[model samples]
Target: MDTPQPKQLSPRRRRALIFASLAVAVIVGTSLYYLHPIGILAPKATAQAASTTLFSKPDTLVSYNFESAQLGWALAVTETRLNQGPFWIFRTVDGAKHWQRQLVGQTSSLFLTLASFQFLDPTHGFVAVGNPISLYRTTDGGMHWLALGLPYADGYAVTFTDPLHGWFLAWPHLWSTSDGGNTWNQLPDPPVDSTPLFLEFDKWNNLVFRSRLEGWLGSNGAGQPHVYSSADGGHSWQRREVPLPSGAVASGTLRTGVQALPGAGVIASVNPSTSPNALFTSFDGGTSWSEVTPLPIGGGTGDLGFQDNLHWWEIYVGALYMSSDGGQTWNHISDELPSAVSSLHILDSQHAWAQMFFAEGSVLAFTADGGLHWTRANAPQPT
Candidate 1:
């Protein structure tokens, strides 16, 4: 007897069943990007040793962390040749003088190493990478990596308040690791469903951990706009009602762009769906919020970065703005943003670095005189 073939759906039906998902990267370190071979602009700073090559081709870079002038990490994935291609990491030390690459894939695979990476310091870090998606830790500043032996979980976003205490998040579930990710235990949560109430399509993913027990969750895909504060790590939550923008019928929540500042303050950009063209600040840890002055940029704060509570930067469509008195007023730091900066790690009022998107690819950029001058930096690559 001949074997039978599986049934096939019609083209119209197949098309109707298709769906798409956006990959988000929530990095808990400090990092950004730029690649150059003597770029159109000359080198302006001497802190960077030399511009280096991270990958030979274009790739997706996410979960960036630049903890200091000499420490940073990020996940770089290339889908150019998918199964037969390479998935590598981007690491820099020695002040971006030379970058070392660690390959994660020997052959092609559909899996991403992890959704994001959290590095507490130059010597300790954690990431969720593997076929079934497992957690890994690096103690020697990512020079070598090992698995935590934790059970397979879909966790892609993680945050750490210290070297040994952190939180892991997947949708609808939150886990805690007190032993530096060697083990993880599921934490208690509110009676709400798996999805978060607010939403953002990017990696900011609406999550920030202020302490071992206090954290802020921005939005999820399946709910209304509401910011949830978890005082007991993820055990339970209290809703901090936010004021809706003027002319808005109702207030909603957003995923990315929720920034936690010193002294239990939070600055968040209101989603257009929730309100429209406004940012808010909360002094009482989201118990209540007040609309601040509009930012200098006439756009959303998708790629917002902060040097501190009083100093800020907003990156959108190649434009960057700096604010001093909250968002009441902003200074156009860079008339033309080098690229969409993922995060800006300001070493001081002058020295800073950023991981960003440029020409549809990942690259590194740095500054020595605030935002006035920028020089492309290098990323990690193979030895």
Candidate 2:
């Protein structure tokens, strides 16, 4: 038995032996199959079955039949060579897939700046008209517009909690409308040395106001921005200095939009600037502030709106960015749009519309799926 022991192969020889064994086994198996057929050969089919599921086209616009829905309405403006004219009101009861243009009286200058449009319900709404100092209301879902003559001088922004209660602000002045925008009475002006600039109303009816009232008002002034709050419906305002990010100076330009969160006294704003624009959040009811984050794509104007306190969306450079983490982070979702977005309006968390301003063209793109996709609604042909 001791003399019959066989020699063991080395590691390298072992590997070679395993490889040779595998090769021999494969060759033998192949030879056996070819030399003697064991199973019948089936004819090959030329065609394969098509996949049953339908896929959405990546570039196709999501359709919404706005003509059947009561909330469906269009916001359009006629832009001239020199200026953009009054905003045209269009309504579609179905969903926004189709729109019927309404005839609002013509204006002298197409320079009619419409800052904002909002509806408390299907039948009642408010529109902020720029330069001429006018706010229009339509109780019949924009079938006809009635001019609410408020003292207007370059009005920048307007918001309404309901048909009877609303707020509008021009620089240095805050006005409240109790009679459905028919008459807007001015609230107390900022201190003689203070100059108030932007205005917003929160869900709790607290008014959030901003300006350089604490410092200087213009370029020569202190160049700092201030935030003020009024709990008693703009009867009196309390001022607080809003802190800016390190190395960032307060931009004197009026902010584009302000949105108020429901439970958290948080307010958000789109800080306008040529450099990287900022989205700011204020937790203490606009008294103190902090920059949420720099927008993903910089350069174009930015606007902010909230579907709720936790969900936020912003539009800049014709793209939509959504943040579910209260602006801590953002996700870019603007592939469907064709042009840069100049303004955005959110009806709720699911439904929204954006106004696209083409650089050299007169066309506008509208989005319904939180800007996931967009469709070209209307455009003026080139002259």
Q: Which stretches of candidate 2 lie over 4 Å from their true place?
A: 1-70, 75-87, 108-113, 127-135, 151-159, 168-174, 182-184, 191-224, 249-277, 295-305, 315-320, 332-334, 360-372, 378-383
Estimate TM-scores for all models.
Answer: 0.74, 0.59
**What tens-digit string does per-residue lDDT give for candidate 1 at 350-376?**
777765543334456677777776666
RMSD (CA, Å), candidate 1 to true, equals 12.1
Candidate number achieving the greatest lDDT relative to the actual structure = 1
**Alpha-carbon shift of residue 33 in model 1 (angstroms):** 28
TM-score for candidate 1? 0.74
lDDT of every model, 2 decimals: 0.54, 0.45
Model 1, total clashes = 26
Q: Model 1 off-target regions past 4 Å?
A: 1-51, 54-56, 80-86, 106-114, 190-201, 220-224, 251-257, 274-277, 297-302, 339-343, 381-383
